[model samples]
Structure formats: structure tokens, C-alpha cells
Target: MTIATRRAQARALFDAGVAAADPVAATTRALVQSPVPATLIIAVGKAARGMAQAAMAACPNVPCLIVTNDENAAPLAGAQVMAAGHPVPDERGARAADMVIAALEGVGAGDHVLVLVSGGGSALLPAPVQGVSLADKAAMNNLLLASGADIMQMNLVRQQLSRLKGGGLLRIAAPASVTALILSDVMGDDLRAVASGPTAAPLGTKAQACNILQSFDIWEKCPRSVRDHLSGVDTATDIPRADNHLIGANPISLRAMAALVPDAHVIADPIEGDVAAAARVICDAAAPGITLWGGETTVHLRGTGRGGRNQELALRIALEARARGWTAGWVCLQGGTDGRDGPTDAAGGLVDSGTLGRIDNVAALLANNDSYAALEQAGDLLITGATGTNVADLGVLIRP
Candidate 1:
């Protein structure tokens, strides 16, 4: 296969993975099996709009509220769509959190609350606990993001500091019947980790959250209010039980990609951890024909340059391929299913054997943690504006 053909095939496989996690289809199917005549619909995350749209269609006349990032914000006929900052908490998200809490408060015992949860929900709904301010939460968020803490660990800490996380929403909507149809962006499908488990159980106690923060050595840098909240004694009562369902996740998307190429090698274990390490795993498993891997990776922000894990992983893979002297035609595509990586507009990067050759200084760029700019110069940045769904990241490699 020619390099061009391989690149196209890689992207096709990646697209298939994304299609499998379509929030609308997933939500519609979930509701069909177990219909929710909801009085209130609350959707939060990158896929919130689509999930809310699907639920609103199923239960017409229901009051719907969607909380999502600015990129995914759009007017929905029957829902109140609020755009909020993602991957980082902001004042807008704080207001949205208040709105969510207020909506939950208004829900009566007889009312059924259909909660659509997806990736980015944690940051999108920063209901800071009593003493903690929104700026504190945002600062903590930046620390976690830059500290290279994995999603789970970061969420464990977030759960302790928020009023609407770690089953806090369930506590708030006590008498109301809450049902969360979750689109799992978490690698292991840990329902609690998805959006910090707003409608699910807490991942662990406040002590554990404190432990994680200290383990990362960022505890000292954390705001005093945050530290106090996590260390404070737990006087809250038990969280009310809710019906939580896993509607979609990364594994499903991986399977979907594998289905497109019957002979493809699907990495059973997700590609996770550091970007360079994850890239090594992908390169090591690159077999002839399509090979697929799915999971989110972490990038330690040592440099001032900008790029997300997916972009860094892609560039790292290209460098790995070059170092390994893989002469045969091959292409690798790594991207976030949400269609945006880090702070950049590009989804991720699609690079081939010749990608390194096209770049002027691959090492300098990688050293600076500027994969987006490097990929841009090489014309390898994969630009797919807001897929309207999030199930972590997906990778596709084609070799001949």
C-alpha cells in the first residue's frame, strides 16, 4: 500500500472508532430498553448536547439543561445549553454548576431526573465545596493537568473538592429518582471516574484524595481552601442510590475499529501512561494491516509549548518509527474522540514514515512539547472539529 493510502485507511479506522461512541445513538438505544419519562434532563460533558438532544426527543416536553464546552455549544430546541470551560474550571462552569444544583433542587420526589454524563463533566461542573472558590478549583485543575496525573487520580482529588461530584448530585437530588446514562471516557469504564461521578458513588474518601494530591507533590501548591476541604471531617450523610448505566466507552470504539478490519490486531489493554511510553507500546505492536489501540494518555508539561497527549503520542510514534528504521510504508493516526486535543483546534496528529523527514527539527519540537506546531508544519495535524462525543482517545496504525 502506498503511504497516502495507508494514511487514509488509518483515519478511516479511527473514524469508525468514533462512530461507535456516538452519544445520540447510544442514548437512544439505552432509553429504548429502559424508557425514562423524565421531568428533568441534565446532560453534562463534551457529549452533553447530543445526549440531551436524544433524551429530549425521547421524553418530549421535559425541561432539559446541557452543560458543555464552548466548542460543542449549540442551540438545542428544547434544552438550555450553557457553554463552559473544559479541562479547566472557570466562572461560567461555576454558574452552570449552580444552575444544575438549582435544577436538581427543584426536582420533586415524583420527578424522574435523566442525567446524561460524559467526559469533561468533571471540569464542566465545578461545584466547589463551601470554602473553596472557583479560582482555587481552576488552579487545582491546572496543577493536576500539568502534573501528569492520570484522569482517575485527578478525579479522585476533584471529587473531594466539589459539591456536585462523588455522588454529590445524588445527595442533592435526594427524593428524586435519578438515572444516569453515562458515556464512559474512562479507560476502565470506572463509572465513578467519569465526570467525577456526579450521579454515581464516590471513588474514595477525602483522605484518599489528600493522599493523591500529596503523592503528586502538588499538595503544597494547592490552595488552602482546597487542602482544608479534602482534609476536613466528613459529616455528610450517605448518597442516595441512583440507576447508572454505561451507554458507551473506549473498548466499544476499539471493537468497532477492529470490526472494520477483520484481520486487525486490537490491543486488548489500553494504551495509557506517559506519552512517550504509550507511543512505544503502539509502535511495538504495529503489525501488518490495521492495528488499533484506545485509551487516554498523559503528557507532563515540562515545556511552555502547547499540545495534547494525542498529538504528543503521534509525534513520538513517528520518531519511534524513524529510530526503528521501519522502511515499509506505514501510517499512524492518534486522536481524541472528542475532536479536540489540549488547547489546540486540531484533534490530534496523523503521521507516516516520511513525517519525520518533512519536519525541520523533530527533537527540538518534541523537547518543547509542541507537537501541534510540529505536526502543523509537517501537515500531519488531524483536524476534525468537535465529534460531539468523548470516549477517550483512539489510535490506528496501518502497515504494508
Candidate 2:
């Protein structure tokens, strides 16, 4: 097959993957199939609007509170839709979190709280624990982002810092039958880490937070209030056990993508660490057939270049594949299911053998962390604008 055909096939596979991970269909199916009547629907994250609509369809007239980022905001009938800051929290996020707490308060024995949890929820809802201010939390978040801490580590610290996380939400709605419908964004679908486990269980401790902060070399940099709070935090007791269901995630998307390719093999190890290393590992493991991967990767911003982790990883794969002198007919598409990568308008990047040859300054672009510019110049950037469903990122590699 020609390189063009391979690229087309990869794009087709990505489209299929995204369809499988769409939160609207998954949320409707999960809730409608269960046939549970929820008293209140609390949908949080980038997919909040979509998930909230699905919940309304399933339950038909439930009161809802949809908290999401500005880009993901949409109108919902009879639901309070509040737009908040994302990838970082603000006062609006803090208020929305308080609203969630107030909305859940005073629930009775049989009322069910249908909690829709998805990616970006952690930033969309910011309820700092007592003694710690929102500014402190934001500073720590920026620090963590700069430190290249993945979702798990960032959430481990976030869970400790927030009053609404780590099973705290479940605790607030103690007697109510609260069931969470989670769209997994973090690796391995660890509920405790997703959205810092608002409706799930807590797996982190204050000690762990301290260790993480110290390991990141930010312990001394942390605000005094945050340090004091962590130092004196007690092991929370009597926290309610978590009952959450997965509606969609990266694995689900990967499965749908795999169905399009008979010989597709999904790599078991999650794509993590630096983008170049991940690309090398994926290229090495891939055979003369399609390979599927689902997970989020990190990009430690070396230079002030434009691109998300997906774009950088895609470009890295192209650069590395050329370095290794792979024969032609190889294509890789890496993109976030949510259709937004980092702060850029592009979802990610698509790269092939042709991509490396198109750019004379490929090394410089990689060094400057400017895959966005290079990929855009090559007409290889994937731009799909807020997909209204985030289940981490989906990657497809084709080797012929």
C-alpha cells in the first residue's frame, strides 16, 4: 500500500476510536441500561455537558448541576450549567464546587446522586481544604505541571489538598445512594486518581503528598498554609466506599480502533514519560501491522514552543522513525479524544515518513518543542475542537 493509503487508514482508525469513546452514547447506555432514577445529576469535567444530557435522557426530569470549562459549556434543560476554568482552577471553579457540596447536602436515604466524572474535572472543581487558599492550590498546580508530574501524581497531591476529593464527596452525600459514572482519563482507570476521586475512594495520604512535593523539589516552594495543612492532616475516617461505573475511556476507544484492523495489537504498557521515548518504544514494539495504544503522555516544555503532548509525540515518532531508517509505508496519528491538546487549538498531530522529509529543521523544531508549527506547515496537524468527550488520548500506528 502507498504511504497515502496508510495515512488515510490511520485517520479512519482514529475516527472510529473517537466514536467509541464519545461520552454521550456511553453515558446514555450505562444509565439507561441500569434504569436507575437519580435525584440529582452532578456532571463535572470537559464532557459534563454531554454526560449531563445523557443523564437527563435516561432519567427524563432530574435536577442537574453541570460544571465544565468554558469551551465545553452548553445549555441543559432544567439544569444549572456553570462554566469554569480548566487545566487550572479559578474562583468560579471554587464556587461551582461549593455548589456541588450544597446540592448534595441533606440528601435522604433513597435518593440517588448520578455523578458524572470525566477528564478536566480536577481543574473544573477546586475545593481547597481548610487552611489552604485557592491561590496556594493554583501555585502548586502550576508547579506540578512544570515538574512534568503525570495525572496520577498530580491527583495524589490534589486529593490531599481538596475537601471535595478523595471520597470526600461521597462522605458529604453519606446516606444518599450516589453512583458515579466515570469516563476514565487517567491510566488504568484508577478511580481514586480520576478527578481526584470525587465520588470514588481515597488512595493518598498526607505523607504521600509530602513525599511527592519533596520529590518534585517543590516542598520548600509550597505555600506555608499548604505545608501546614499537609503536615497536620489526619487520616480521614469513615469515608464512604466508592461505587462508580466506567462509561468510556482510552481503552474503549482503542478497542474500537482495533476492530478496523484485523492484525491490530494494542500495546499493554501505557504510553507515558517523554514523547520521544514513548515513540521509540511504540515503533520498536510495532510489527508490519497496525498497533493501537491508549493513554496520556507528558511533554516537559523545554522551550516555549506550541504543541500538546500528542502533537509532540507524533512529531517525535516521525523524527525517530527516520533516524532508525524505517522503510516507507508507516503512519502514526496521536490525538486526544477530547479534541484539544494542551492549550493549543489542534487536537494533536499526524506524522508519516513524508513528514520528516518535509521539514529541513526537524531537529530544531524538536529541540524548541515546536511541533505545532512544523506539523501545521506540513498540513499534518489534527484539529477537531472540543469533542465534548475526554477519555485521555488515542494513538494509532501503522507499519506496512
Candidate 3:
């Protein structure tokens, strides 16, 4: 197949993966027989608007509150859409948390509260525990992100420092039934890691949180409130477990992509750790037809490079392909299911045999972590503009 066809096929596969995780369809299917007698729809994360819109369709007059990132914010009738920061907490996100808490507070015994949880929910709902300011929480989050800590580890630390996380929201909404429709972004759909388990119980402890901070050597640099909160004695939060439904996830999207390509094989496990390492794993195993991988990757951000993990991974793959001179006509795509990667507007990057030919300074671009610019120059950047869903990142490798 030609390079153009390979690129189109890769993007088509990705779009299929995203379509499989559509929040509207997923939410509608989930609520078909579920008992949400009276819904105070509280949707949080990147896909909050779409999820909330779906819930509203099911219940026309149901009151809804959408806490989502700015890029994904869309106007929905009968719903209050509040834009919040993701990957980091901010003052606006803090206020959104207050509004979310307020919406959850009044659900009586006869009411049903539906919480649409997706990726970035933790940061989007930045309700710091008493005595912790938004700036303090944001600083701690930056430390966690920079520390190369896994999502679970970072969430463990975040849950300990948040007021509405770690089952805090469920506790306040008690005496009423709560159903959380979740879109899995973290590996294993570990509720504790997905948005810091806002409506779910934390499987970790404050001691673990403290250790992570110290292990990262950011304990001293962390905000005073974070240090104080972690140092304080643990208090038991006895909250009823909200019904968490895994509406969609990375695996779900991966399966969809796999079905689209003949002989496509899916890596059962999602990729993790450093982006370069993950890129190597995919680059070293590009088979004919399709090879699918799903999972989130981390970037150490050494240089002032502007790119997300997916962009970084794709660029690294291109670099590796150039070094090894992998089989001709092989194309690979690496992008987020949420349609936004890191600080750039592009979702990810698509790399082929010809991708690096257009640029002489490929190594420099990769070194500076500026894969977005490099990908754009090659016309390989994947820009889908907010797919209205979050199921982590999905990758496709095509060899023809």
C-alpha cells in the first residue's frame, strides 16, 4: 500500500477506536435498565459534556453539572458547563469542585446521582482538602507529573490531599443511591487511579502518599499544606461504594481497532513507563496488516520540547525507524483517544518511512521534546480536536 493509504488507514483505525468509546452511546446503553429514578447528573473529566448530554437525553428535565477541561467544553441545554484545568488543579477547577459538591449534597434517600467519570477528572475537580489551596495542590500535581510517577502513584498522593476525592464525594452524597459511569483511562480500570477515585474508595493509604512524595524527593519542595495533610493522622472515611460501571476503556477502543484490520493482533497488556521505551516495543514488532497497542505512556520532559506522550512516542518511533531502517512502507500512529496530547493541539503523530526524510534535524527535535513541531512539518500530526471521550492512548502499527 502507498504511504498516503497507510496514514489514512491508521487514522481510520484510531477514529474507530474513539467511536467505540463514545460517551453518548455508552451512557445511553448503561442507563437503559439501571435505576436512576431521579438523576442529578454530575459529569466530570474531558468527556463530561458528551456524557452529560447523553444523560440529559435520557432524562429531559434532569439537572446536570458538567466539570470538564476548557477544550472539551461545549454548550449543553439544561446543563451547567464549567471549564476546569486538567493534569493540574486551578482556582476555577476548585470552584467547579464546590459546585460538584453542592450538586451531590442534596440527593435525598429517594434520589439517584449519576456521576460520569472520565480521564482528567481528578485535576478537573480540584477540591483540595481543608487548609490546602489550589496553588498548593497544583504544585504537588506538577511534582507528581515531573517525578515520573505512574498514574496510580500520582493519584494515591492526590487522593490524600483532596476534599472530594478518595470517596469523599460519595460520603457526602450518602443516603442516596450513586451510580458512577466510568471511562477507563488508567490501566486495569483501577478506580483509585481514575480521577483519584472521586466517588470510589481509595485502595491506598496516606503513608503511601507520603512515601511517594519523599521518594520523588519533592516532599520538602511541596506546598506546606500538602506536607501537613499527609503528616496528619489518618481518618477513616466510611462512604458507601458507588456503583461504578466501566462503560468504556483503552481495551475497548483497542478491540475496535483490531476488528477493523484483518489479522490485527492486540497486545493484551497496555504499555507503560517511559515513552521511548514504549515506542521501542512497538517499533521492534511491526507486522503486516495491523498491530494494536493501548495504554498511557510517560515523558520525562528533559528539554523545553512541546509535545505530549503520544507525540513524543511517535517521534521516537520515527527516529528509531530511521536508525534501524525498518521494513519499507511501514506506518505507525500514536495518539490519545481524548484527541489532545500534552500542551499541543494535536492528538498525536503518525510516522512512516518518509516522515523523517522531510527533516534533517530529527534528532534535535526529539532531544528538545518538540515532536509536535517536527510532526507538523512532516504533515504527520493527528489533529481530531476533542473526541469527547477519554480511554487513555491507542496506537496502530501498519506494515504492508
Candidate 4:
């Protein structure tokens, strides 16, 4: 078999995984027979549009608001749609969050607030707590990203700074019956971390947020307002009581993919490690079957690499396969569920042993943080534009 053949098989398995964890279909089915009449639905994140479409199909005529990345605007035709920046807060995201807060204000005691929550919501709906500017939040976020902090730690810092996160949105929808349908991107499906748990119960302490920043050596770079907010001098609002449900996650998606591909092996539902090291493990272990792993990874960003975690993982894995004298008939893929990796337009990369064999300066590319360029030259960058969904990172290794 050729590298192309292996990649094709891996792609099929990945698509199967996504189909199995369809947030829209799953959420719609869950809410179809509920006796409570949903008065308003706010769907926020990469999966917002799909989840909103499903919600509308299940319960027609309900007022709906969909917030997603700017690139996915066309799918949300009938709803009040707000396209915003992601992975970092921008003015547009803050504005959308204000709209969501206003929408919550209209909910009556018995009215239903159906929230479609997923990854990227934290950045998409950036309603900062009083006294924090969008620029301030953006700087903090960038600092965290470059510092190699994990999602859990990053979200803890974000929850403290945002009025819509850390269950603050639940407080805004207080007295109303809130039902949150979540498409989890975080490991363990920690509801409070997914989209910063806008509609879930608050889970972290102020000290925890401060510690995360301190550990990353970013406490000084954080905004003054953010620092004051987490210092406990002023009391922050708490997450309100709401019924939250996790509709989809990496485990579910990886399991679905495993079922589609015979002799499949799941490396780990929550794979974690140094990006390059993890790549070496995958390349060494992949056999004559499909291997799946799902979870977020951290990048230290020492090099000026124009690559995300998934892209870097692919490049590293390809290099490892070459080092082991492995050629053709093996494919490795790493991609983010949100269809964006790092600050690039790529979802991730799909490469083979042949790719490494062709590249002469692989080390230079990796050292320069130019995995995107290297993968592109090797014809291995995976480009799915935007999938309109985010559950985390998905990696597939196939050997034939």
C-alpha cells in the first residue's frame, strides 16, 4: 500500500468519528420531547451553527442567537448570527457577548434558556468583567498561549476575566430554567472549562487562576483589572444553578472512529506530552491498522514556527518515521476539531514517511516554528477550511 492509501483510510475513519459525535443531532434528540417550552436559544462556539440548526429543527419558532467564527457565517442564515474572532478576544466578540447578556435579561422565571456551548466560546463571546478592556484580555490570552499552558490552566485565567465565563452567564440567566448542551473540547469534559463553562457551575478558585498565570511567568503581563479581579479584594459573581449536559467529546468521537476501522487502536482519549515527543511515540507504535488519539497538546513555542500543535505533531511524527527507516504505507494525521490550528488557516497536517524522505531541512523547519511551510512543501498539510465543530484535537495513524 502507498502513503496515499493509508491517508485515505485514516480520513475515512476520522469522518466516521465526527459523524458519530454529531452535536446537532444528539442535542436535538435530547431536547425534542421536553415539556418545557424553550423561549430563547443561544449557541456559541465553532459548533454553534450546527447545534442551532438542530435545535431549530427539533423545536421550531424559538428565538435563537448563533455566535461563531467569522468564516462560518453562511450556515447561520435564519438566526441572529454574530461572527467573531477566536482563540483571542476582540471588540466584535465582546459586542456579541453583550448581546448574549441582553438576551439573558429577557428570560422570565419559567422561561427556558437553551445554551449550545462548545470550544472557542470563551474567545467568541468575550464579555469582560467590569473594568477590563478587550485589548487587555487579548494580551493575557496571547501570553498564556505562548507560555505553553494547558487548556485547563488557560481557561481558569479566562474565567476570572470574563463576565460570560466561569458560569457567569448562568447568573445572568438566573431564575430561568437553563439547559446547556455542551460539545466538549477539554479533557475529562470539565464543563467549567469548555467554552469556560458560561452556563455551568463555577469550578475554580481565584487562587488557582492566579497560580496558573504565575506558573507561566505571565502574572506581570496580565492586565491590572485582571490582577485585581483575581486578588480577592473584590467579590466576583458565581455560576448559577443550571442543568448542564455534555453532548459530545473526544472519547465519544475517538470511539466512533475506532468502530469504523477494523483492528483500530486508541492510543489515548486524552493524549498529552511534548508535541514532538508525542509524535515520535505515535510513529513508533502505529501498526497495520488504524490508531486514534484525541486530546489537546501544549506547545512551548521556542522557535518562530508558524504552526499549531497539530501541525507540529504531524511534522515531528513524519521525521520520526523517516529516522526509523519507515517508508510508504503509513499515514499520520493530526487536526483540531475547530478547523484552525495555532494562528494559521490550516486545520492541521497529514503526512507519511515519504514526506520526511523528501524534505532536506526538516530540523531547520521545526526549529524555526515553520511546520506549516514544511508540511506544505511535503504536500501534507490538512486543510478542511472550517468544520464548524470543535471537540479538541484528533489524530489518526494508519499502517497498511
* lDDT (C-alpha, whole model) for all candidates: 0.91, 0.86, 0.86, 0.82
Expressed as tens digits, the lDDT of each residue in 1-400 for candidate 3 is 7888988898899999999999999888887867466568889999889888878888779889999998889888789999988777888898888988887787788888888899999999988888988888898888887777888988898898888889988888988888898988998988877888988888578888888888877789988878888898988967786888888888888888888775887777788889889878876666567789998988876678788899989888887877886778989899998989987799998888888887759889888888888998888898999888999999988877
Per-residue error for 351 in candidate 4, Å, reads: 0.5
* Best prediction by lDDT: 1
Tens digit per residue, CA lDDT, model 1, 15-133: 88899999999999999999997999999999999999899889999999999999899999978999999888888999999999999999889999999999999999898888999
lDDT agreement of model 4 with the native? 0.82
Clashes of each: 0, 0, 1, 3
In terms of TM-score, which candidate is strongest?
A: 1
TM-score of 2: 0.95
Which digits, one per residue and each the tens of the lDDT, describe model 2 over residues 7-35? Answer: 88888888898888778899889976787
lDDT of 4 by residue, 225-256 (tens): 88888897535555468888778888988888
Candidate 2 displacement at residue 217 in angstroms:
1.7
Candidate 2 residue runs with Cα over 4 Å from true position: none
For model 1, name the residue pairs that clash.
none
Model 1: lDDT equals: 0.91
Clashes in model 2: which pairs?
A: none
What TM-score would candidate 4 get against the native? 0.94
TM-score order of candidates, top first: 1, 3, 2, 4
